[model samples]
Target: MTSRALLRFSSCESLNFPSTMQHAAVISCVFISSLLHTGQFALIETKETVWAAVGDQASLSCRLTEDKDVLQITWQKVLPNGEKNLATYTKKFGSRVSAGLEEKMDFQYESLQSCSMVIRKVMEEDEGCYRCLFNTYPNGALIGWTCLKLYVLPTELHGPFITISRSNSPPGSVVTCSATGRPVPMVTLTVLHQNLSFSHYNTSRVSNTNGTVTSTTTALLSALSSTQVECSVLVQTAAFRELLVTVPGLTDSSDGLDEDFESDDKDERWLVTVAMGLLVVFLCGAFGVLSMLWFKKKHQNR
Candidate 1:
């Protein structure tokens, strides 16, 4: 109904009430009528922030507080430069996604009063704020905003490559271990064998363009009594990788001597094989010469 007609009706109703009650009754009627006319009760509810890991699906939803005859709901992504419409849902048209975002974004749930959008295989570029616009008759549009944050956690830990360099000063070996992961993984060194002594040398970090960090740590080993050292690469308490390395000069001297003796034995066997081969060749030649001589004597006797 028209505002003027409603006000007239409120005045007529208020005439039956007492002075103090009439004012309150009229005010209530006018407020209720105004709310009905403006459709201001159509508010949307949504989460403030949604977080998801990269390559995972991120779902964003919006629901109207009060039921309304909504025509359509448009989902938009808020960018630093401007906002871009990603998808839309309507009863008549169903769901439609933007051209480039068709593979990445789509409507998960479609309704006039409530809707949700899903981003498949979420990437770093997909991290941003989004808004859902509810289009209603007479009310224009109601908007609700939600922001997305993408996190990249190390999934499969690769390696803790260890390299050793012998140092003359103080008579120790310098051990270096490195690993690459997202969010800067931590590298640590420990001596696994007993009687092994080591001290911290230094650590360095490098950032890559692909959003990964390489961490390297160096340590000085004091004693040669221990042979085994370990390197641990960790992103957090949840994810970790470990590698074991053998110190070159710290192994038993007997093992080296045995290896050398084995090598010498192999060389002796090879020399024997060559010598036997030569003896076979000489014997074959002698047999051929003796056969030729016997055949010549038989021919001369014939």
Candidate 2:
């Protein structure tokens, strides 16, 4: 009975040994695979989009999440034609720029693990996407893409000039808001009075020689009982300026026109008064000189 019990226990141990070996083999393979991938691959951290004003400096950078055996780092500018190599950094050679790109851009920070470059004077031609490539061993090249956007901001924004005219047939006020800025600013018109309603139409844009744009938007005002309106001007996402103008009543259109004419009349009258006073001063000086000359001649004759 003891021999039979021992034999049964031995068979049970033999049956479980193969199962244990299979489990150990699987765990070992998983561990080795994780190690290989962790050593071979790297994560690149970078900004997706960077913005800079024209004639300003722009910085582009990238970093590695894990330590990589980076053989070389290449910075490429994406163009409409093709990808052009701008600069490169290596562990052995330090940093080097391409033949023609030395003055345009330079390496801000350089290392095997992280790198950055700055464009000294950004221009419209320099606006495009850039790529940072990590040439790593065994994993080939790990690439990170970033784009640079260039803009020409207006130095001085022109007036959001508001003008009102009478529409004879519709019997309402025709309001126009205009502004000038770089990159074509957006113009918005709002009527402040609750009883007033307006419909916008005919937005026109004109490009200037100095790389600026003039935008004019016209709206038809109906039931205009209010005396005020708002105008907003925006360039890209930035709020450039805002203006408030007086809206003459629909029935009071003639009043607004008359007021403008009256203002012009006042200006003309002031100019005429200045001219008349200057002429009188000249005539009085001439008369006094002639009388003095006549008296001197009589004295000399005596």
Candidate 3:
């Protein structure tokens, strides 16, 4: 072991042994794990993935091992294209957190031993891999990595989008409800009245040109005396949105109206056919009389 390591290990024996012993034990484990790196020694405990919902807060914490004099702590984010420097904090310079992220992060314990950050109102862009680094005096640097996944909640999930139209052929109604969200929401349909039943249904999901997803559900109702139905959407982020569709006629049914229009067209065609037959008979009688008159005048001349 180097002199710094020997001094650090011996100092724990002189100080509060219980608390200092914990640091020594963690430091010894890190040193053994880094036989290739020699003097660089630091370890932190945290999860590899953090799941959060849009418009909600998330936290990433890191606790260093046997770190007394921490020079700087840095947080970085890795995206598909490249890496972005998120924030940085130094004991002497205070904090140099990013512009928009200043109000979103909490830097209460900005030191070398413990570096923690809070993400406020997580958004879709926040989903990515994050790296936390601690630069200490003789130990060099310690790094810990984590990833974030942010889910979007359903939006504008209300109003005429939820509708019920009366069934013309059958003695029931067809109910359709559509909701939009990211991470594709899971939609469920339920009739309000106790005795109502769902005979059959169809559901489809479409990916918009934008980043959002739209889900539409159609439910066939039989013996449905219910005045309303409910559509509940659940997102991956544990956030949910719900809307109720009053069975009150949202669409009109025009079944058999086209047959009435066809009947009227047939009656008009029959009237035109009868009028043409009468005109043809009148023209034939007039031509026969004129021929008779001409023949009589020729015989008189002879």
- The prediction achieving the highest TM-score against the true structure is 2
Question: For residue 104, what is the lDDT in candidate 1?
Answer: 81
TM-score of 1: 0.44
TM-scores of all predicted structures? 0.44, 0.60, 0.43
- After superposing candidate 2 on the true structure, give the runs of residues whose Cα lies further than 4 Å from its correct spot: 1-42, 181-184, 190-198, 207-213, 223-228, 235-239, 246-302
lDDT of 3 by residue, 1-302 (tens): 55655655565455555776767775774465456334343366667888887789988877776645678888888877866777888867887888887887766564567777788888887778888878777766677778888765555333226776677676567888787766676778888787665667788999887767788888877642336678887776566777886564322233334567888899999999998998888888888888899999999999
- Between prediction 1 and prediction 2, the one with superior lDDT is 1
lDDT tens per residue, model 1, 248-296: 6634433565899999999999999999999999999999999999999
Q: What are the runs in model 3 whose C-alpha is more than 4 Å off?
A: 1-42, 155-183, 186-204, 207-234, 239-302
RMSD of each: 15.7, 16.1, 14.6
> Sorted on lDDT, highest at the top, how do the candidates line up?
1, 2, 3
Worst 10 residues of 2 by lDDT: 1-10
Candidates sorted on TM-score, descending = 2, 1, 3
